[model samples]
Target: MAISSLQEHPGSEVTVWMADGIYPISEPLVFGPRELGEEGTLVFKAQQDAQPVISGGVEISGWIKNSEGLWEAALPKELDETSGFRELFISGKRAARARFPNEGYLRVKQAGVDRRTNFYFQKGDFPIPVNLEGVELVFLHDWSISRIGIQEIDTAADQLIAVDSIGARIPAFFTIDNWEPHPRYFLENAPEFLDADYEWIFLKSQNKVLLKLPQNVNPTNSKVSIPFSQGLIVVEGEENYPVKNIHFEGITFQYSKWEIPEKGYSGIQACHFDPRPSNEGWAVVPAAIISIWSENITFTDCNFRNLGGSGIWFGPGSKNCKIIDSSLKDIAGNGIMIGEGQDRIVNGQPWWKSAPEQVASGNVVENSTISQVGSQFYGAVGIWCGLTAQTAIKNNVLFDLPYTGISVGWMWSPEATPARENIISGNHIHEIMNILSDGGGIYLLGLQPESKVLDNRIHGVKVNAGRAESNGMFLDEGITGVLVEGNLVYDIAKSPLRFHRATTNLVRGNFFFSDDSNPPIRYNTTDEEAIEKVDNLFFSEGEPSYQKELSHAISRWEKKQRKKRKR
Candidate 1:
């Protein structure tokens, strides 16, 4: 209301000053076209020397020691029996959901006949909690993770049936394959599994939260926060009316949560999911702070942490937006998402190109630190840019991720689209590809002419639990006219550079080092003429000739495989 009234004076900027301390809101603070006038700017600025937090969490208190030496807390009066949360934070650290086999995963003995609703567990592998209510089965795919509720477990048959279908569309991705004869799985959210320290289970029927904490720590002194809302801010605008010129600074956005749908969270890749049938548009998990159809928006010196979903998103039609000097940590999904997912239909056909006015372009994320992401969803990336042009991702430090560090381009084929001239440069990316396979430190897909991947330091990409190999820079499928130069890629388990189904990519002046059986450069379904590699040094221990390097790569691979077989 104050912002609207302040807009009465045209051409004058409207400023909302937030003071230090936490400002909890029941719902997301929305800013739409109506909140922004045509000419002036709207600024949500923290006071000088102050850092304000916009939180969507409710603190739970009134703790008491239970008979089993666990701590229990009654729900607040404002909460009811339906208030079920999937995440809980104790003393600023995320507490594990009550899960069986607390340390690692249990392997499936055999995939079910349908392969979408049931699987056969090994003998004595079933968790068999006291009750199946509120229990979920988490299935780990090659590059994604699926969560579904348990409907029945026939111990006599060693089969477990899910309440809904698993969250994968393709059979090869979800079913048992030669690479993984038995998929990994775990069970969560049952009282019987709450035996480990910092594991918790909430009983909505009892209106209480049961927590297993350290014996020395008192529950009354610990700060327990449960997120009640999905998002903290939403900046949305229509096609014809776009919100513009808004800025947020010196703010910390935290404690947002996202619930799994009843059907399940079937992860596809990079946090995109197949919520419905195929050929329809897929869904990307929403973020804690989102902007859609907006322009000239900025978030400077902001912090996003302890979230149940992605940190920030610049959705469709967002232009000239920037997230500068920010830090994103402990995120459950992708750290930041830019642009829209592929397969959005328009006019009764699959939408392959963005409307000129609806493309998310000219956005930038610089000088940021993103770590400990993909905490809940293993397929999430640090930064995902899809079908956007002229987006600059620079000077960011990204590590401790489960999937790719940065992914640009969404189109899987060499088709014309509104994605070109994107830049990924000067980022320090390491310790990525730690969980999933078929991803790289920097992954480029589709046909992005004139795009550049330069000066990024990428390393520590080891082999993970997946069928396909990982790389330092994976130019996958239809990549063309991109210049890869001056990047230092090393310490990779597979290859430093890989090209699959790509053409005409210029690779020059890059230092690629590998200490394994894989070559520094690898090509699949691609011809030698397709990639122009000039002055690129390929080193295992020292720089070797390209021809000699190929033979050494084979010998090294054989040695590694022999070692693995003996193990």
Candidate 2:
């Protein structure tokens, strides 16, 4: 019979026969790539009763071939258990060798199994060469099948397989090679491959990234040199790269402590360079341990602890900044300092032979806790705002501070060209002890125009006799348009509130109480009569002498008001 083109229907087997005993089984045979596709079985069967002596009980087994011309034998009913296994075989000329490529491995339960079988053909060893580039090989055993190996042929093909296996886009930059161990090990050990020249290099480890400084590359212009403009550039575990206009959330900076000149070495020093006053050059003198000099920046929900100097410091040029919902503790200097720049003038002569530059402006620090700062000999304020305009310190809770809770001062430039508009409000300050320092809950000094100190609660402020001048709130010298109102001051050692050389200030609606050995409030060289003492609840109700003095002051105020009406 002559062979013709045949087509098979669904669920039915088709057979084809050629003349001269050369038979081709077209049914149950799929010719194409061997991939996971539609679920159907391909079975090939030899024609029964074709010859006189039928090979009965001696069945001839066959296998399937893939696009790479590799033959994989089909498993019997008991051996075909897993759905992932596929088989292929190859045919070569002269010497037929069925070679399993690297991609052909099956994981099986019973370890030792014969993978090669010897079959004698009439044509004296017909050679079959197996091509394995894109072939799938499967092995089957009784009731169990295993995948022993998987061959990744090419890089692009392997990447495609990986993406398809994971059902997602493979991360472009990741430690895929080190999938067994931690990924950081690969990132840290391997050098980054970049096309362009980058000065800074960061090696990320498990906990931190170590930034290697270029060898012997001293920056002539600045002390601390940051080579990168953006992203994380880890510098000795301190990431100090300049990130422009990007919000970096939930990053912790661990700085090594350096000792002060007086103290022994081994603490983190707060060293940041300030470009202002131009002539001061780089203020390499350590200011705060972790000084942030970025403009329009905010640090929220952060922790800055165990530092040698201030916890966080902001330079003068830093504006519209916020440090909120953070805790700063156990520092040698102030906890959080805003605008504490160096004095432009060194001595009688300006450092640049002129007045110091104008200070920074518009800093806000709110909803923070500062505690356990400054050792016995040294003193530190909780929140210190210096030489900055429109700076606000509000809703903070400060305790165990050696000097003051909140201090606003013009200590750097006495000229006050920049007009510090400081506001300290709604803060709970207590337990500040300092000797030979103006210890207070809130201290304002030297020409803060338009400053408001309101709604603060202060208690347990102690000043040792002949040690320091203590007050709940102290305003000193050349402060104008100041309002100290609605504060509860109690248990103060010296005075609840004191003013020295302060002018045009409104002191009203404050509750001042001092129990034994401390004055309720005092004023020195200030226009005490002009201070509005309205609605001030003083705790002198039981003491008749104190009450008489309070009455006399009220009468004196009334008499002065009548005289003003007459005038």
RMSD of each: 6.8, 34.0
Residue 11 displacement in candidate 2 (angstroms):
62
Q: Report clash pairs, candidate 1.
A: 167-266
What does candidate 1's lDDT look like per residue over 1-567, in tens digits? 546754686567888899999999878988888766655788889999998999998899999999999899987766664447888998778999999889788988877887678878887875577677788898887778888888988888988899867756643445544347687889999987888999999887788899998889887887899887779899998777888888999999989989877767888888988665443557888899999989999999999999988999999889899999999999999999998866666665545443444678999999899998898998999999999989999889999998899999988889878888999987889999887788999999999899999878788898667678889999999999999997878778798889999999899988777865778889999887879989986777554564465455445534644563476
Cα-based lDDT for every prediction: 0.84, 0.45
For model 2, what is the alpha-carbon lDDT of residue 453? 91
lDDT of 2 by residue, 321-428 (tens): 677777776554567777754455545653322433335567788878888665311345677676678888887889887567787775422345565568888787
CA shift of 308, model 1, Å? 1.4
Cα deviation in Å at residue 246, candidate 1?
1.1
Model 1 residue 268 distance off true place after TM-score fit, in angstroms: 0.6
The TM-score obtained by model 2 is 0.47
